[model samples]
Target: MMRSSVRGFSLVELLVSVAILGLLASIAMPVVELTQKRQREANLREALRSIRHAIDAYKDASDHHRIAVDNGASGYPPSLLDLSSGVTDLNSPDGPKLYFIRRIPRDPMNGDISVDAIKSWGLRSFASPYDAPRSGNDVFDVYSTSTEVGLNGIPYSEW
Candidate 1:
């Protein structure tokens, strides 16, 4: 009589493989989460920097008399929308528009909602104190509105 030999994984071996896979997955999950969080943090920083730069540019133009500003105004953009919507150039009588940003960036800490971009950020007017930032008549600075703590143990709003 002729016999053929074949081998298959035993139940014990299969169980051991599944347990190892579970252990590896458990270890990888937190690392993946951390990487994602770090990416968001980087995005947050970039957004903040872009907005701040625009604000500075608007202020510079105002200071240089390139753009007309109110007497009591802080020379900052009246609102975040004003930056994206463009401002009237004082140098041009035909009313040429000077745009600061193409569009306001959404807060990364919060979900990226284009419609609610303005509301998602914590605005700090020039008149408002740094320690207690508040939205006033002007847009001087922007911060994340999220209350979550970052990986560095600092509040997202403070960053």
Candidate 2:
């Protein structure tokens, strides 16, 4: 009987292949993690910018007499919800509601999904100090509540 040839990878070759694969995977892991971090950071920046712009819009409306306010009011919104929930526009014939942002974005840096979007952010009122943010009667600005430091060496809370 003629012998049939069988071909297969040697044990050493298989181990080497596996080792190479493991090395490649090891090299790729940090890159994957870094990418994820960058993405989240981007989201955080966008969220902050959106909230800030909405706050500015509210103040602008109040300044223009479009939204009624007390004589000494800062013209800022009373709460984050006010931005998305809409406000009465005095300029409209029927007092139509004026909308800023459709929805307040959750803090990307904060992984607490149980909290509502409005609560996910750290609120800074018109009366609060920048170095020490605190919620007050009016929401002057919004920031990430995360205590983690960013890749740029800035605290997420200050971002």
Candidate 3:
């Protein structure tokens, strides 16, 4: 009777396979992390954009003297909460629908949605440090609170 030999990978082959896998994992890990970071940054950007847009809309209406202006808080909502809670009847001189953002988004890096703490999204109003509301009113200034380096070789705050 003739004996037949079964083939199996050698120890060297197994070692080489393991080495390749390790190398691949090392390469893939960074890419995955970068992708996640970018995604978060993108989300933060979108949130900021949404808030800014709402603020601008409010400002335009206010410029036309359509929306009522708040004296204590200025044209901008007193707090971020007002964006969601709806402006008080006392705050609105023109109408009550001058709310900016429906709900503030949490900072991707810090995951903070609290209205007090400065984060990514900032509402545009006369008090805002950036864009003023039409004339002197600062509509909004969206800035990333994150100090981490973004994928684009720029800091999140700079974005």
Candidate 4:
């Protein structure tokens, strides 16, 4: 038989490798968190935009007399559901139903799609003060219910 030699990682080398991996993981964690925050912020923007657009459309229809609206009431929809549930056409009582949005998008900050979308959002009625938004008789505006500060250094609710 001839002498044979085999090489394997020494304890020091293995420890160094683990240390490097730990360092890399530490550096990567914040980046991953930031990326997720940005994604959620984008989703929040899209959700707000969609809901706002639907509210605007409802108001427009009400203003144009295309949809029946209560006298002395703001043209805004009474509830977000009203947009998706369909509204009656004032032009013809028997006309096809008018719908604004097919479905209400969930609040991205909450990330709870199972919950009611209306509950997930902070609603502002036309009668509510802009500085202190609150859901009331109608849905004039929508904001994220999250109090978390975004990566942009602004409160998610302010966005």
Best by TM-score: 2
Note the Cα lDDT for every prediction shown.
0.91, 0.92, 0.62, 0.90
Residues 1-159 of candidate 2: C-alpha lDDT, one tens digit per residue = 999698999999999999999999999999999999999999999999999999999999999999988889899999998899998888994866999999999999989889998999888988989998999899998888898999999999988
How high is the lDDT of residue 21 in model 3? 100
Query: Can you give the lDDT of residue 141 in candidate 2?
Result: 88
Q: Kindly report which residue stretches of model 2 are placed more than 4 angstroms away from their true locations once superposed.
A: 93-95
Q: Give candidate 4 misplaced runs (Cα > 4 Å).
A: 111-114
Question: For candidate 1, what is the total of clashing residue pairs?
Answer: 0
Candidate 2 weakest lDDT stretch, 10 residues: 87-96
lDDT winner: 2
lDDT against true structure, model 2: 0.92
lDDT tens digits, residue span 1-159, model 1:
988687899899999999999999999999999999999999999999889999999999999999889898899998988889998888995867999998998898887566488778989998899999999999889999898999899999998
Q: Model 1, residue 93: displacement in angstroms?
A: 3.6
Q: Give candidate 1's whole-model lDDT.
A: 0.91
Cα deviation in Å at residue 57, candidate 3?
2.4
Give me the overall lDDT of model 4.
0.90
Model 3: per-residue Cα lDDT over 10-128, one tens digit each: 99999999999999999999999888988988887787777667666665555566655656444544445555666434345565565666777666766556644333443334543
Give the TM-scores of the predictions, in the order they appear: 0.91, 0.95, 0.66, 0.91
